[model samples]
Target: MPARPDRQSLPYRDCVGIAVFNQQGDVFIGRRKAEGDPEQSAELGAPWQMPQGGIDKGEDPLKAALRELHEETSISAVSLLAEAPEWIYYDLPDDALGIALKGKYRGQRQRWFAFAFTGKDDDIDVLNPGGGKHPAEFDAWRWEKLGRLPSLIVPFKRDAYDKVVEAFADIPRRFNLG
Candidate 1:
C-alpha cells in the first residue's frame, strides 16, 4: 500500500465561518445548495451548514466572515460580537480528499466569528446575492438553536461546528440577549 501523506504535506485552506444570531438568540443556519456542487453529489448527506467560505489571499478573517455571510445569506445587518481566540481545524473525509476544495487543501483551518443580527428577519435572502462576486451557497436558510448545529452539518465538519458552538456558547450571557 502507498504510504499515507503526512498532515504537514497537506496544508489546510485558511477559511472563515460565521454564526449570526438574531434578537431571540437563535443562530442563522443555511441549507447548502448542491445543484452544481463540484465535490459533492446531488444528495450530500448533510444538507445544512452555517455560512463559511475560504479567506481571500489578503483578506482579514473577520472581513471574510462578514463577506461570506452576506454572500451566502444576503444579510448585512450584523455586528460582531466576538472572534474565537484561536484557529481550529478539521480534516476532510477520505471521500473528499481528492475531490473537495479543488483538491488543493486537506481540509480547513478556520477562524470563527459570532455576530448579532440587527436587521429584521426579512433581510435574509438566500437565493439572491445582495452584492457579491460569488454565487449563492445556500438555497434556503432559517434560524436555529446553537446547540443543534453540529448535528446539522456534514459529519466531517461536526467537530469544527462543535468547537464553534463552544467558543460562542457564552454569547447570550455576554451580550445580554437571552
Candidate 2:
C-alpha cells in the first residue's frame, strides 16, 4: 500500500477574495454549486460566500480579486474600498482534503479586497458572468449584512471569513456615508 502524504506537507493555494458592498452597507454573497454526493453536499449549511478565486501565476493580488469578482458575479462597476491588512487562510475539512481544490492544495491563503458597488442592481448577473467566458461559480446571489457572513459560510471557512469581516469592518459604513 502507498503511504499517504502528510497534510502539513501540502502547500496552500494563493487566492484573492472580493467583498462588494452595496449602497446600503450590505455585502454581496453567492450560493456555491454543490459538489460530490448528496450526503456530503447536505453538510455544507448556508453555503453562501463572497467571490474568490486562485491567483494566476504572476498575477497581482488586486487584479486577481477584480477578475474573480467579475468572473463569478459579473460585477465591474465598483471602486476599491480597502484590502485586508494581511492574508487570511483556511484549511479544508478532513473529508475534503483529497477532493476539494482538485487535490492540489491543503487549503487557501487569501488576500481579500473590499469594493463599493456603484452600478444598479440590474447590472449584476451571476448566470452569465464574464460573458460566459468563465464557469458559473454561484447558483444564486444576494446582498447581506457584513456581520452575518461568518455564520452563513461553511464551518471550516468561518475563521477566515471572520478575519475578512474584521478587516473591512468600517469600509462599508464609511462608504455609505460619503
Candidate 3:
C-alpha cells in the first residue's frame, strides 16, 4: 500500500474574501448550508461567515473578490474601502485534511477586501445568488459587528478572520461609517 501524502505537503488554494460593511459599521455574514452529516457539522463549526471563495487562474485578486462577493451575496452596490496589505492563510484541521476543499488544498491563502455597502438592504440576497448561475453557498444572512467575525467562523478559519478584522480595523472611523 502507498503511503498517504502529508497534509502540509499539499499546496494552499489561492482565494479572496470580502467584507461588506453597512453604515452602522456592521459586516455582512451568511449562514452556510449544512454539509448533511452530524460529524462534518461538528468539524466545520459555526455556519456564519463573510463572503469568500477560490480565485480562478490568472484572475486578479481584486476582481476575484468582487466576483465572489456578487456571486455569494447578490450584492453589487458597494464601494471599495480597503484591501489587506498581505495575504492571510489558515490550514484545515487534521480531520478535514482530505475532506474539505475538494481534497486538493491543505488550506487557503486569501486576499481580503473591505467594501462599503452603498445600496439598500433589499439589494442583498443569498438565495438565487448571481441570478442562479452560481449555487447558493449560504442558506441565510445577517449583519454582524466586525470584531465578532473571528468567533463566528470555524475554528481553523478564526486566525484568518482575525487578521482580516485587524487589517480593516480603521475603516469605520476613517470612513465615518458609524
TM-score leader: 3
Off by over 4 Å in 2: 1-4, 35-40
Expressed as tens digits, the lDDT of each residue in 1-178 for candidate 2 is 3354568988999999999999888999988877653312667577789999999999999999989999998899999989899999998887777667877788999999999999998878888889888888788899999899999998889999999989988975676623
Q: How close is candidate 2 to the true structure, as a TM-score?
A: 0.93
What's the residue-level lDDT of 91 in candidate 2? 89
Clashes of each: 0, 0, 0
Clashing pairs in 3: none
TM-score pick, better of 1 and 3: 3
Q: lDDT tens digits, residues 1-178, model 1?
A: 4444554678899999899988888898988878767454554477888888899999989889988888888888889999998998999877667567886788999999999999988878888766555587788888999999998887888899889999999898789876
lDDT of 3 by residue, 68-136 (tens): 998998999999999999999998887767667877888889999999999998988898898888888
- Best-to-worst ranking by TM-score: 3, 2, 1
Give the 10-residue window scoring lowest on summed lDDT in candidate 3.
Answer: 35-44
Task: Please tell me which predicted candidate would have the highest lDDT against the true structure.
Answer: 3
**Which residue pairs clash in candidate 1?**
none
